[model samples]
Every structure is written in C-alpha cells, then in structure tokens.
Target: MAGVDEPECALPLDSRDVRCCCLLRSFSHFIVKNPTMNCSVQTPQIVGKDAKQHTLSPTCTGASVLGIKFSDGVIIAADMLVSYGSLARYLDVERISMVNDNTVMACSGDIADYQLLKRRVEEQTHTDSLLSDGFTLSPRALHSWITRVLYNRRSRMNPLWNTYIVGGLESDGKPFLGYCDLLGVSFSDDCLATGFGMYLALPLLRQRLEDQAGGDPRKLSKENAVQAITDGMRQLYYRDCRAFKTYQMAVVTSSGVEVRSPLQLETNWEIADYVAGYE
Candidate 1:
C-alpha cells in the first residue's frame, strides 16, 4: 500500500487547484491526499448579533392634543413642541396636520412615528385620488384606518408610539371626532384629549359643554367650539411641562378644513406670585 501511487484527478484549470481535487474540495482530506503539500485553512466567519430592529425608545415626542365638536364641526389643537425626553428639542413643530381637504388629524407622541404614519396616509390618499371618482377618505374612514394600523403594529410588539385625534366632517356631512392611541384603543367622542390634556384639559371642556350646551356637542356654536379649544390649549401651556406657548389648531367643517399656522397662546403668570408649587 505504501508503494501504490494515487490515481489521477480531473485536470485543474489553474495553479490554485494544484492541491489535488480531493484536498481542494475538502480541507479535512487535504493532508491525507498529499502528504508533502500544505493547504491554507480559513476560519469560519462569526457574525455578531444584530442591532435592535425597531424603535425600542422614542427620542422626540410631542405632548397633548385637544379636540372638541361644536355645532359647525370639529376643532382640534396641539402645541408646536417636540421634546427630547424632558428637554424641549424642537420648537414650532406642527403636531396637527390636515389629512385631506375636509379632514384634520393630530397626535401626541413620538413625532417620527407620526410622520411615518402621515406618509402612509398620504400614499393611500394619493392612490385613492388616482381613481378619479371624486371619492376620498372621510374623517370616520381615516380614523378607522389609523386605528387598524396602530393596532396591527401593537400586536407585533413594535408599536408606533402615538395617541391620535382625528376630526372632520363625515361622508354624510356630519361632524366626526375620533381618537386612537399607541395600543390601538380608539373611540369617538364629542370632546377628546390625549397626553397631559386628558388629565388637565378634558374636564374643563366637558364642564363647559355641560353648563353651556346642555351636554350636547351640537348645541355649541362654532365660536364656542373655537373658544373651548383655545381655552384648553391655554390651560395646557399653563400646566403641561411639555407644552409650549406656541401651538396650532385645525378647524374642520362642512365646507372644508382650515389649519391655522403656528401661533402663540396668550399666557399669564400673574398668579405665580400668590401661589407656590411643592418643593
């Protein structure tokens, strides 16, 4: 057996294949095939763990969004502030935006997530517009769509951290106000508030409606609705640490939607001298 010569292999095309075919195909059989020749061994590459794929923590976030329904239609307000943790990182950021000619939506949470949601909505709207049938997403339809999307993301455990308030005229020309949150929880309300506004501003509007409009949102005049939202935003600036004096509001009605540019709310620290906060 020691005197027996190895059988010939298929001729290799290059010098790289000089090590016999058996050894070239498998490093384990290299030394056995050719005792005098040497083969270079390569270590298998080890890939490291991948970085976190989804948004595990939100960096830029907005605060409360306040909405109210009046006899004319629905009005929603949000301060123009995007905070990085406790620091006010962005000023004059518009949290409330018009989704269509007749619909408006606002969010209180991670601005980036909301922006992504906005693009999705816009793409859907564009696709619908391509139909050219004069049909578009009504306030109710958009609200439902946003709810489903948020819920779907939540189910996947990578939620788009946003609490939304959508308002406008329904397909039937009736005023509609709907809310959706990060977990996809949603409901329609005559008056709605998210984030800090839920605790500080909601009660005020509810009380005002009860006292002036007999608890019926339709009884309130358009002026009253605007006044109520204004007051709520004002209160938020006074109380919500994340709230800014600068804000924006959108009014949706049978005619169309009007989103006011960023404006400063009139605030007063007059009572500051008389009151002291907890140490």
Candidate 2:
C-alpha cells in the first residue's frame, strides 16, 4: 500500500488492513523483479588493466637484415624499402649504418624506431669520445652495450620493435657478428638474418658458408662472404614481398667500416609469364 497509492476502501478496518498488506507485498515483489527502478543501489563497474606501459608493434617496418662473419671481417646487407602493411611506403631508406670505424649495424622493423636507435648510438659514441683517452668502443663492446640497452627497454615493456645485426671486427681484428631483437634476445653466430631473411636467405647463406668453409663462418674468405651476402639479398628481393631490388651493403674490416653504394638486384619474372594464371 505504501507504493501502490490506491484509493481508500470503505470496509471494516481489519479487512482494509489485510488488503493494504497484500498490496504492499505485491509492490515489494515488483521492485525485486525490476531492480533498475531502485536508484539507491549501485551497479558494479568493470575495468581492465595491463602491466605493459606501452603497446609494442612495428609500423612502417623494414624486412630482414642479413649478416655474415668471414676470415677478414664481417658483411651485412639489407633492402632499402620500408613497408607500411603491404604498401612500400619509404624507398631508399638506409637500414644499415656505421656505428663507428669498427662497427656496423643493420636493422629490420619500424624505420622511425631504427632512426631513434641510431641517434642514441651516435650520442653514446660522442659521449665515449669525450671520455676516452684515445680508446674507442670496439665491435664487441658496442654490441654488448646495445644488447644491454635493448634488454633494459624490453624489461620496461617499452621496446624499440626492431631486430638488429651488429657486424664488424673485434679489437683484435677478429670477425664479429651478433644479433639482437626487441625482447633483448641476443646471440653470436657466423651467419644471422632477421625477418623473412631468416627463412629465405639463411639456408642459402648456411649452404654457401658450408661449401666454402665447412660451416666455419670464420674461415670464409672476404670475397666468398660478399658473394654469399649479395646472393642472399638478391634471393630476398625475388622471394620476399616486403623486400625490393635496391639495397645497401656494408663491410667491416680491420681498416674501417665501408658502406657500399645502394645497388639493385637483377630480377627475372619470366617464369610468371608461363604460369597457369597468365594474363
């Protein structure tokens, strides 16, 4: 009766009271059935939280970077194209850079992030120069430093979203090649590749290296190393969708790091002309 607002009934007091009690019970049941009408009760809210401070994904990414260590030095190669999804967004982008006279770095992933990483390396190099008494960072030392930096960023959940290959000669003029990724995972190898190069180019490199040096990358000659890396790049251009014919190559030796001219690979599409779906 308290919620119904019914007109007064002209009846005995006991009967009227009974009817009022019944009405009140009905009103209580209705409120329970439709809880939304009860403004006093609050509904619980749902929220999602994540530990990661930043989202990690590559945008406008470059493809594989290939590296090989040889008797004299190290050789690295990467294509010049940066792709945004399937679209080749940036052409002539240099993915290979000389960190110092003794080291070269090649990277695959977001070009913007790679540029930022390059700036950081340059800053570190400058700082080292200021502090050094005629002592510079060697290839091994630089690679170790970069590995620590990448690992720290990964631990913070803010990664560079790139895979890097550091190749050069150690202080003792020994060939050095190391690989690092966004997660700070790193290892040294006679041959290394990132992205599709790992799938398409790695086998070729391994086979060639084996033929030339019995799988001993350190035993490979400079000419054979260059040939292997160049052939791998050509194969990548032919097979990888994100790759292109134009690329940059770098060789690091006891003398210095040399980045050769941007070169183009010769591609043959003659097979496509005879395919079943030929136009």
* Per-residue C-alpha lDDT of model 1 across residues 68-94, encoded as one tens digit per residue: 999888999998899999999899788
* Candidate 1's TM-score: 0.80
Candidate 2 is scored at a TM of: 0.81
* Span of 10 residues, lowest total lDDT, candidate 1: 12-21
lDDT of 2 by residue, 1-279 (tens): 244344487654565776877877888889899988844866675654663357456678999999998888889999899998899988988899888898889899988888888998899889988987777777777778878988998898788888999888877778889999988899999999999899999999999999999998768899999889989998998788898989999988888888986888877888865668644
| Model 1 local distance difference test score | 0.88
Off by over 4 Å in 2: 1-53, 274-279
Weakest lDDT window of 10 consecutive positions for candidate 2? 1-10
Best by lDDT: 1
